[model samples]
Target: MVETADLTNHFLIAMPQLTDPNFSQTVTYICEHSREGALGIVINRPLDLRLREILAHMDLEADDAAVAELPVYLGGPVQTDRGFIVHPGTERWESTMEVTDGISVTSSRDILGAIARGRGPQRMLVALGYAGWASGQLEREIAENAWLSGPADPEILFELPHGARWSAAAARLGVDLTLISGQAGHG
Candidate 1:
């Protein structure tokens, strides 16, 4: 059986024919991997939300002078009300996951406060919610060819424009999304 550890720091690119309303054209970055299950955040789906808006709702001080000009992404279906920050390695915070060589996810409010104060990582993705799978579920799906896994690219996760993330991730595998077929096949 495949293990989550084997898929850590990887990208789960949706298959061409993926029709799930929540996952179509999604690019996910795996964070925690264990025998129990795995957790990741979708790096490409935006929900018309922003950091300032979220902070305002939370009643957390919004430092307009410092917040970067970036939009928050819908990480996944879980806990859409919460916040998660994926950023560069140079910045440090509590409850962080080094998703890749230079990319990390921080769940602590401290990092958010820093970002709001203009003292956070130079590059970052603020995600609300995350994608997850129970033990063996993700492996079973992979066996069914529901996804293609590849190493996560830091720049692709943090530097590219939000709308381009899906295509950019597929490009790493030499795939043109338009050529993909959502229908899964079985022999």
Candidate 2:
């Protein structure tokens, strides 16, 4: 059966055994999930690219140096050419989609322009591409203990350092991934 359970605004913590190079040790924030499929941005994988570099490429200059210095993340393996911004805001933008009450994902250049002008939301994660799962693919992965799902924590997503996110996310659900064996027991 396809999962009807909405994972919007949830965090999928990769289990210790989930050695997929794309998702292992990552904390993915689910932005949209439906009967058809799911889309998410991996929160903890920082790409070497900086926002300043992206801005320069787009010919958008930032008013604030720190904002320009923000790290751009490797969101996932899909659509690596695109950019996505995850932020907490209620304002609608040209391509903004509300993942929850205050959480949103915007791909429009307008938002990036605002960010460049120091008018963007205070907290944001800029990522390239996103994690996607075909219908029932995530459910099957969960059933196989490839991931642990729990409420998404804004602080973990926006405030914490990238290296700390995985354990911190799993700890929110009281799981110590290191304590779990990578090899599963066969019945």
What overall lDDT goes with each candidate model? Answer: 0.81, 0.93
Residue-by-residue lDDT tens digits, candidate 1, 1-187: 7643478888999886677888888999988777788899999998787778777665665555346446889999999877899887846688776666677789988887777776778777889999998989899888877788888888888888878888889899898878776565797
Most lDDT-accurate candidate = 2
Model 2, span 2-102: residue lDDT tens? 35478889999999888889998999999998888899999999998899999999999999999999999999999999999999989878999988888
**Which candidate comes out best when scored by TM-score?**
2
lDDT of 1 at 50: 72
Mark the 10 consecutive residues where model 1 has the least summed lDDT.
60-69
For every candidate structure, what is the RMSD over all alpha carbons to the true structure, in angstroms? 2.6, 1.4
Q: How many Å off is the CA of 32 in candidate 2?
A: 0.7
